[model samples]
Target: MKQATRLMALAALMIGASTAAGCGTSAPVDATGLRRVVGTDLIGARGATAADQRKIDRTAVGLCAGGVWSKDECERHGEGAR
Candidate 1:
């Protein structure tokens, strides 16, 4: 009876650990937020001139395109092409 109880406790502990491990694996992607951060990092705090801003936008689009962002979204931002 004690051995059975110990086995049950071990099974419960394994289940709990598996559930906790799965919890950290499923975060949603924030594409718009990512783009904004990338743009700001590329541009600068004071901001850029029209030409510079265009360049920054293109670079941001390219960066996002290489990752999870869809082709349509990347094109909308003007970074669609390789």
Candidate 2:
């Protein structure tokens, strides 16, 4: 039937589009996860200050907005502050 063929084509197009969209998309990351995304050095270097730490914390909060990861994601990655 023409209607059945058209529906099948539309379904195939939708599936192909969704798959193609993710072709260029990278996986999302948490705070600990971000170290893997951007690297541990950059995250630590820029996260040294109270203000900078706050920025990292905020970004982590946004990343794990749904509580997907624990609070440590927003905490300092190193031993202690200087």
Best by lDDT: 1
Off by over 4 Å in 2: 28-82
Q: After superposition, how far is residue 77 of candidate 1 from its true place, in Å?
A: 0.7
What do the candidate models score in CA lDDT, each in turn? 0.45, 0.41
Evaluated against the true structure, the overall lDDT of model 2 is 0.41
Q: What is the C-alpha lDDT profile of model 2 across 1-82, one tens digit per residue?
A: 4323323433454356445545656843323543333232223325335665554444444434544334674343222322
Instruction: Return the TM-score for each candidate structure.
Output: 0.32, 0.31
What is candidate 1's lDDT per residue for 28-76, written digit by digit as tens?
4544544453343343312234554455455445455546345774565
Between which residue pairs do clashes occur in model 1?
none
